[model samples]
Target: MKSSTAQYVMGIDFGSTTSKTVILDRAGNMVASAIAHKGSVSNDGAMVSMAEALQQAGITEADIARAVSTGYGRRMLDIADKSYTEITCHARGAVHLVPDARLVIDIGGQDSKVIAVDANGLVSQFAMNDRCAAGTGKFLEALARAVQVPLEEMGPMAMTAVEHLSISNMCATFAETEVVALLAEGKRKHDVLGAVHAAIASRTLGLIARVGKREPVVMTGGVAKNVAAVHHLEQVLGMKLRIPPDPQIAGALGAALFALDEITSPDHADEEDRVDTEMAAARCGTPTCTAKKPLPANVHPLHGPALH
Candidate 1:
């Protein structure tokens, strides 16, 4: 790897179902970003996303001065200079996307979070639903399959609903059963889809209540792309949500910003030491240390472990 005091940095969000990477120049301009789907929090997904972002930016891994990571598999990235919780990163990312955003609602594949952020992009309070799959993209996927409707089309079809139906249970399994029962009772697919989105919106409102509602709310994560989800959330909140141009990359963008901060600000320069300490605490002594394992041969790391 050639290194002449790197001029770029990278941030990665290793989500449960998808991974995102963003590259930024020294000035914090986003040079490139990429997302890749995975069955779970697989390292391959992270590698693919990072590789793609690097390719797009026309830079080698060595060009990055620092790398920060977040999301489910954050610590798994051997190249990461630091790692932060999803809440911190999402709050930072959302606020960056919408400067006045006071509340951030992120509904990812397997979890949902509502964050109350300060003007300085710090999380004041946050509520998350990680215990169950309810009101998440996974829940929507299961219900979509049960309804024999394509996941992408469910949003548009739901918009045509003529009635308001209900799915009482919050459990994905139970929700699927209830959906089937609703269909058995001759409920139209459109109305059923509407109920599904409404259920998610209701659950989201519960989270928002925990953090207390704030103005200029921003919705991030993969679910933000769903029209029905956004519409229903707006309906329940009775306000329009500020969604970023690329909603799914918010965490990644936030991570990138943090990486940039670590380099530019003397206050954050010690983040790398904290990250190293945390990684040491989590690392296994086994020869195949998952935490420090290298990425696949095709992918290059920005720093740290040598890619095979």
Candidate 2:
């Protein structure tokens, strides 16, 4: 605890569809961050993303005093000092990006989540759709392919849509078929794209219903880059959304923030020694306490964000 204030910390979010890394100084300012959309995840991919982030920050691994990992493949990073759920990390990152944010909607590659953050800028209730790929980024990618449009071009194409084509299904596979059918029926590509956005927005509304709504909603994940998704979701929810400039890296940012908290805590030195001792004594050939501690009993298991 003797002035770890100048230390730099790292956060690695090894998600299902992408790997993102963020570095921050103890003051919680982002030093550098990088997101790599690599569908197949490995330690090497995480390392590459972290290396890129370090390169951007003009720093190296030696500079990072602590690190945390989050997202679907969080445990793959053996170097992480800690690991937290994406629910907690996403909430932390969203609140950091938009402090007034009450509801956070994240449409990640394989799933979508709706998180409710309370007045204190911490998570309250949360809901997610992990079983199905519908209403997620992958769903959009499938539809884009069906329409013969590059995935990156679909959003802008949707913007030019003058008419909406109601898609019959929200299921990802069925929706792809619908997109193809719409095209065969001589429908406009832009209009089909617009309908896809609305279909996703409508499905997101169902998630929002379960979590309930709060004003000043913000969105994160790669899907936030889609103007039509944001626009259609806003139209459906009737509230303007707050989107961070780097929405996709919010989870990594939150993990970096957690690292900052961990490295500078009053018990930092003691905890470090405790973890080392636990590993040595057990001789399990593992970092016994690193990234393995559960949330304290006083905090809600699913909603705690560990803010500074």
Candidate 3:
């Protein structure tokens, strides 16, 4: 395999509410990465959107020796050199960020995942909660709206609570209703926010407990940025959770690592030749094979989407 030090690889993560692209050298050192706000490829064309992200990062198509796509739209990216599940990519990315991480908890826009990793930065076992949106970004967004606060301010607002209010509802709609009721009762904003954080933390902890708590629980995904949620999760799990400096970009980083592997693999040369032939044929006006389309909006597949 070629060392990441000698080649450039590109990774794209087509997330549910945003897309990110990362460029890295053979050593897995990131050159540049960019995140763009967009709907999941499941509801939009993920591959086309990913291409735009790469362009924004100034990474031309030819600059990417190998590309790996992950997230909900992975399978829909026909241009990806390879595709991987979000769980695998998240595990790989988390392990790379925190080499000693035994457990990984990633809370994205639409779902959450828990992963266990071994000493070699490989996934051991994993669990996902995609069927519900209770502890996801969407849940937080709804809560923020109910509280008349910006989504970005939820974490700080949660930290200001002098008392922890009770949130009895786990459903997003019901939870929003609960917030409104609390406000009507004259509950302080901070206390209500704290309760919301606790609710999400409790739900997330339930998922983590299923995989068995381990030391150095690394939190990734967009939700990790929420300090209040992180604090609540730590209290619930009774273990300190480590958040990477750039948690949201972990999946894209892992994709870049996979790209490095594909470029350096012994079979890559032949694969490139085949890909070139295919591209040439397509350019010559031959009917080219199309990549898979994004999943429908209502479809909630258990596994993450394919890589392009």
Candidate 4:
């Protein structure tokens, strides 16, 4: 007999710059997701904001059977059924979206991470450079301003550079100085922008190398969509990087997929089992379902795997 249990899960990525919530059915299909523009909500406000996001997705507070929170402010989400590091969530999310992804480079607004995944979608090792803004979305935003172009136009404009100018510094302050000098030199705006992209790509490639090069390299996070950055990265690495549709949503998507896996397999709560199930479903071409039961108000938040 078909089980009547409805299985709706909620995944919230409370990033440093923005917060996003995704609702998925038991089958791991995205039902509804909402993105909030501001930074992570304060501890007292997380539940309220999360509830509002759920409502936006037509999810009642009672409908979410499991809630997994990730990102910089994940620990502040006291109401979550569990909380996970952004690295694990991103790796699982990337593998869920692209099963063949062996490497994941997630460059978020303030941090960048490179994760190596085995054939089973398990994260083998990873490295991150979160202490600096030089290799992240903020770096690109600052460069766009230095070039007097809107941020959205930076990517396509960067691709137009016929000559590759060199940026001497990786530090944001020093790089800004370099950009000013390039501008004074009467270099083409596109060339300067290309130089900036090249600088960030070089630093990111260094991080990827630390994790060991592997293919197919899947680039996630907001900066992955920047054509110039992507192009420069490919050139520097001498390998093609795969950028998925809506790269900014990868973490949230991964969290949602993790939620689905938890609901489907109650007994096997290990991270490896969850990854295996997601990979299996993706490989078998099974349709992800959206059925879920309402969560009880008093139920305790889910806890992630114990840190080693």
lDDT of 3 by residue, 1-308 (tens): 22224357878888888777778866667877777776655524354545665566565665666778899877666557667888888888888889899999999988889998887888888888757789888899888989999988889989999976889536888899999999999999999999999999988878887888887899999999999999999999888898999999899888878777665663854565466555644654345534344656765322122211
Q: Please name the candidate that would achieve the greatest TM-score relative to the true structure.
A: 1
| Reference-based TM-score of each model | 0.88, 0.85, 0.81, 0.82
Q: Whose lDDT is higher: candidate 1's or candidate 4's?
A: 1
RMSD of each: 4.5, 6.9, 8.1, 9.2
Stretches off by above 4 angstroms in model 2 are 1-6, 266-308
lDDT of 2 by residue, 206-268 (tens): 999999988889899999999999999999999899999999999999888887777666376
For TM-score, candidate 1 versus 2, the one ahead is 1
Q: Arrange candidates, best lDDT first.
A: 1, 2, 3, 4
Query: Local distance difference test, per candidate?
Result: 0.87, 0.83, 0.78, 0.77
Model 4, range 62-155, lDDT digits (tens) per residue? 7777777888888666446567788999898888878899999998877899999998899999999856778887787777778889988988
**Candidate with the greatest lDDT versus the true structure:** 1
**TM-score of model number 4:** 0.82
